[model samples]
Target: MVVLFVVAASVFGLSSEGVRDAVDDVGPLAPLVFIAFSAALTVACVPGPLLAGAAGLLFGTALGTPTAIASATLGATAAALISRRFGASALDELSGRRVTALQDWIAARGFLAVLYARILPAVPYNLVNYAAGLTRVPLAVFAAATAVGCAPRAFAYVALGGSLDDLGSPEAIVAFSVLIGMALVGLLFAARDVRAARAARREG
Candidate 1:
């Protein structure tokens, strides 16, 4: 599915706008096409916010959030596994201080590490997938964390996107609130992780 999407995306130059056009081209298979294209773009580390907006433009908030979550999880898992298979050995050879420190931190925290990464808006979603691939975290743990941790933000983004025309709508207001809440919670997690990392270094 990913490969197929990639090929179609290559032909269409997939973006949020492009996705809509592509979906229009395939009336009955729009749902599958959306997920496939989104996942492919994600695995390629080529698109982000635009894809969520496309989800809203196509399916509205109710259906868009679930589809976005599904695509994101699938794409993240595929990217991580690809990196694990092909890039881990290469990355493990480099022991740069920052690299080693992050590896140790993530390896120590496992699922929580991924959950934190997913929620923290500052963290790049695609980068974490690749980085986690190089770590000892299990694939199951990675996928589960990605799904759960990303849900809130996914819903928020899709809802906001769906309500783009009516920024003052109830749905838009609620979506903004959700984004703000997630950002605050993510910051708390980040602060805790930083403190823990410092303490661990001192212990070692």
Candidate 2:
């Protein structure tokens, strides 16, 4: 199902340019196409940063950020749902003892776990969604954290996309570095927590 979603998204994205041109030739369909593609990309695990950036690039900030939020939220929700349904086998296969132990710690931390995973870029977005699904994290809390935590990273991409004129310039590099730094900090914290948990587990 995940593979299917990715294939579908790729097909849709490939035709996006033609679709946009068609909408321009016709009328009133441009926004619809943008929303649909954004949603599809999100569901397909194409990466929120890339999607947000594309949204800003295509629509500009005023329209782009809102569109990104809407489409990304929908996509993320759908992906979580799908992961909830088909995640058991894949998760069990991907996660070893260490990962499972880490998940246990996350369950203890609840919303904070979700928050950290959402904030950190080291964790694959799809994997986090699936991992959360496997735990007892409440849907509301999961959605809230995902929505809020995703904003900073998503907005950064959208901002960059909106300013494509500065692509490859020093400012763009600095902006990207800052975003990566923030993500790394969050990841480092999570890593520390994981290490502490492992030590405690070994001791106990």
Q: Pick the candidate with the highest TM-score.
A: 1
Q: Can you give the TM-score per candidate against the true fold?
A: 0.77, 0.67
Output the number of the lDDT-best candidate: 1
Model 1 alpha-carbon drift over 4 Å, by segment: 1-28, 94-105, 194-204
Give the runs in model 2 whose Cα sits over 4 Å from its true position.
1-33, 87-108, 168-174, 198-204
Q: What is candidate 2's CA lDDT for residue 131? A: 61
- Model 2, 1-204: lDDT tens digits are 223423544556533344335546756656567778887877777877777776665665666677777777677667777776787557768889987887678668877778887777677876776567776566677777877777766666666665565447664565577688777888788789899999999999
Cα lDDT of model 1 by residue, 101-153, tens digit: 88888888999889978889789888998888999899999999999988887
Candidate 2 differs from the real structure by a C-alpha RMSD in angstroms, to one decimal, of 6.8
